[model samples]
Every structure is written in structure tokens, then in C-alpha cells.
Target: MQTPEQVAAAFDLLADQHDAMRWDLALSEFDASVLASLEGIATANVASSALFLAGGSGREALSFVMHGWKCDLVELSRRMLELAECRLHKFDLRIVESEAARYLADTTEKYDFISMVGELVGYVQEPRSILRAAALRLRPDGLIAVTWVDSSSLAATRQTEEQGVVALVERDDLEIRAWTCETMQKYVDAARLTVVLRSGRMAESPRRFWILRKEM
Candidate 1:
């Protein structure tokens, strides 16, 4: 298995190589389900007419929204936020480069559509807290599209032995938890949210996508 440090280093390498890193390759290597969700997001347009992208990197998603849904992207990385700004200069995109956790907690801003791709759920220190808080801010009938790695997979377990740019290392150094589908669904129900879509996909880590709507 590759070391966790090696996984991080690989992303840094991608950042150096492509102006925008290709996570689709990583997802194809882990779980196939990721592609389906991406395709879905690309096609679906929210009724609230407002979409929010969490942990957005570069601007692939925001580009979609700018051209399709007319929404904003909020992220945690300063580097990513800036790069997105540069890429999305022509569009009316909003980028908030603050800790996603803090933003979720402090945000009074309500969104009709919330998208969190690329295991954004696991990236936060408290995935449940962030999800629940975000759920509350939604207008009833608002949608939360969240994806995370299923802990059963080799990549999720950090047991992957694959070579050539796959994340093999367990990021134990990052104080975050890996979640399975059931665990995430538990959090969704606990947040008093309703599940509208439930399915798994094959991506970099056997990713799972959930489409949730806040219950009135």
C-alpha cells in the first residue's frame, strides 16, 4: 500500500502538473459510482435556482453551475479558491476560502442546492456536524448532494496496494473519520433530513452519493 504522505504528495504533484487536477482518474481507480453522480449533477438543475458547491477545487463544478445553474462555490483551500477565481473570471461565481466547518456553523445563508463532491464529507474534522448544520440552513425541499468513501474499500481502509498515482496511504494524520453508507444515512436522519436518493458508485475509493432533501 502506498503511504498516506505519498497520497498527499501525489495531489501536490497533480497541482503542479495540471492547472486543474483530474480527480476523475482517481475516482475511476477507486469507485465507478463517482462518474454517475457527476453525470447526474451535470444534468440536474435545482428549483431553488441557487446551487452551492462545498470544498470546491479549481472550478469544474462551478463552471457547470455558472453555465447551467447560476450558483456559487465555497471552499476551504486558499490556493484552490484563488485558482477557481482565475478560471471563473468571466462568470458571476462567489468563492469563500474559509474553513468549511466554520462556514457551515456560522452561515445564516440558506441554499436551495448544496453539492459536495470528491469525498468532501470526509475532509472535514466533523463530517456529521458539518452535514447536519448545512442541512438546517436549507429551505425545506432544498437538496443536499453529498458523497464520501465507503470505509469497506481498500482505499477507504488505507489498505490499497495499487501503484501509479493512487492514494494508498491512510491519512491518519488528518483528524477525520471514514464513513460507510449506513453511518452517513444515520447522520442524515438524525439531522431530520429526508433521503431522496441512495446509491453507490465506483470511484477512487468506492464512493457513495446521497441526494437528500430537507423535510418540512
Candidate 2:
């Protein structure tokens, strides 16, 4: 299991070319649909608040910010936040320098929407704890969008069972955890969240994108 420091260091090294590399841009594009569907849903004339956990360079969070959602982006890498600050300096959103799980656990502020995309769950050692903390910080009717490494993939399943970590076929040096569908359901149930949406073309990708909400 990769420690937070190790994960942060890995991301810090990628901060400069992160945006240009266009890593996970497809997932970001898919995330915008949720933002579009939720537009103008804030109560009492207040803008809907959205939290971006492990949002790198604020790229995916841009959709939420541009949609007029009040946004907070939490990232562990100093270099990433520096670039995020530069790109989002004119915006009103808060860019926090903290681990996602710690920020979720510590924040008193609740959000209408929380995004843990960019494979944040898969990168972490304790995804269940992260999910639980994020769920606790959500307002009623709030939603969380996240991604996971699907153990349905043969490579992920075999590697995860044998080596304890699955290496990304696209970036072999980057190792991550994978979750089976049943395990993911158990985690979500433990967090008291219901799956609102689960999407991915498993034939094309080993990652699954999910949207979760508290039982209302």
C-alpha cells in the first residue's frame, strides 16, 4: 500500500505536465454531464457547493466552477496546488493543500456535490475510510462522483490477488488498488451511500466511474 507521502510525491513529479498530458480527460468530460444536470439546483439562491478531492491542477473542477458552483479543491501535492492556483487565481474557489481523506474528515463545511474522480480512490490505501469521511461531509441530497479500478479486469484481478496492487497497463510504473463489484457495494453500504450511477465501457477500460448519494 502506498503511503500518502509516497502518493503525494508521485503526483508532485507530474504537476508540471499534468494538464498537457491530458491524463483522464475523458473521465473529466463525462463528469461535466452531472454538473449540467444539477445546474440551478442550489437552495435559497445560494450557489451549490462542490468539493473536488485530489483534483489535480483543477482541470476537472473547472466544469463545476464554470457552472457557477461554489468549489473547493483539495490536493496533497504542493506543486499541483501551485499550478492550480495559477490557473484558478481569478476564480473564487478555495484550493486546499491537504490529503483528501484528512480534508474530508476535518472539514465542517458540507457540500452539495463532491467529486473524488481522477482515480483518487484507487490510488489510496484506505478507500473505505475516504468514502466514509466524504459521505459524512455531504449535505442531504448531495452526490459524490468517483472512480475505481475495477477488479473485473483480468489483469487487475490477478495482479491484485497475487501482488496486492494492480499496475496500470497504460502507465505500468503506477500501481494502484482494485475493487471488485461486491467489495465496492460493501464499502458504499458501510458509508451509508447509495449508488446513483455506475458507468464505464469495461471492454475499453478497466476503470469504473460511479456517482453515490446518501439515502434520502
Candidate 3:
């Protein structure tokens, strides 16, 4: 796993190309799905505040802000946050440049919704600790949404051995960690969050998304 500094540097280097690469990978579809899931939950539960972890370029944050939701976006990459600032100028959003674990540890404000998307959960070395921190900062009836790449899948297994770490745009090292669905579930369960909604398309890749709620 890459340290926070290394990960931030990698993302900073890729900041300019992030949106184009995402579009090329058709990840915007998955992002839309996540936004839809969040929207549904927010409508049903009347969510007002949200905390978005590792929010790259703040696309999801833009959606939340547009919908009249107060958002706090935490990203490790300063360049990414710069882009986000440009995109989310007139919204109720707070942009923080810090690692997710550190930010969660330092914040005492509870949120009605929390999200760690773009497979950011897989990049964490101690995912369980992060989840626990998120759980602690969540309201009793709040929701947490996360996504992970299934490392046990054939595609990920092949990539793990071949391109574990590579240079994106020949600028910085991009480290990819192998995190299976079971591994993610174990962490979520350990954090005492119950899975309420799960969806993913495994035909081409092992990327999956899940929405969890605090156990009552």
C-alpha cells in the first residue's frame, strides 16, 4: 500500500488527466449510480449534511451541493482540491486537503451521509480503522457508501502480479492494492455497519459499490 504522501503525490500528478481517464474507463456511469443511490437514501431519510472522503475532482460533491446538501470534501491531493474549488465555487462545501483517516480522527462533527468512492477504500492500508472512524463520525441513522475493487477477481489478480505499481503520465508512482469483496465486508462488519444496498457490474471488472447503515 502507498503512504498518504505517495498517494497524494500520485493523484496530484494525475489531477489534470483524472476526468478524461475516468471518462475513458466509463467510470462516470458507476459514479452516477452511486449518486443515485445516495439521492434515494437522502430523499427517504432527509439527509442535510454529508462528508465525502477521497473525493477526487469533487464531481459527487457537486451533485450533492446542487441538490441543496451541505458537503465537506476531503481529498489528499491539493491539485485535485484546486480543481474542485473551481467547480464548486457557489456551494455549501468545505474542501479539506488531508488524508481520510487523519481528517476523520480530527473532526467531531457528525454527518447524515458519508461516502468514500472511486475505489478509494482499496487504497487504504488500514481500511477497518478508517471505517471505524467514519462510523464514529456518523449520525445514528446516517448512511455510509463505499466502493472497492475485488482483488480476488481474475482481472485484478492478473494486474496485481503484472502492474502492482506504475507511473501514471510518468510523473509519480501509482500503487494499486488488492482488496477483495470479503475483505471489505469484514471491515464494514467490524465497524458495526450493516449493508443495506449493494450493486456492481462484474462482467468486465471487479469494481463493486455498497451502501451501509449504522446498526440500530
Which ranking of candidates, highest lDDT first? 3, 2, 1
| Cα RMSD for candidates in order | 6.5, 3.8, 4.1
Quality of model 3 by C-alpha lDDT: 0.76
Off by over 4 Å in 2: 23-46, 156-173
Q: CA shift at 14, candidate 2, in angstroms?
A: 1.7
Q: Least accurate stretch of 10 residues (summed lDDT) in model 2?
A: 36-45
* Residue lDDT tens for model 2, 1-216: 567887888778877877555434454444444344334333323567889899888876765677678899999989988888888788878999998888877889998888887788888767788899999999987888888777766564235443344545434335677867788888899999999887775466666778899876
Query: Lowest lDDT 10-mer window, candidate 1?
Result: 159-168
On a 0 to 100 scale, what is the lDDT of residue 181 in model 1?
64
TM-score attained by model 3: 0.85
Give each model a TM-score.
0.71, 0.82, 0.85
The alpha-carbon lDDT assigned to residue 127 of candidate 2 equals 78
Deviation (Å) of 54 in candidate 2: 0.2
Candidate 1 deviant stretches above 4 angstroms? 1-19, 23-53, 58-60, 67-70, 155-176
> Model 2, residue 105: displacement in angstroms?
1.8
Answer with 2 or 3, whichever has the higher TM-score.
Answer: 3
- lDDT score, residue 165, model 2? 46
Question: In TM-score terms, which candidate is top?
Answer: 3
Q: Give lDDT for model 1.
A: 0.58
Alpha carbon RMSD to native, model 1: 6.5
Superposition TM-score, candidate 2 onto the true structure:
0.82
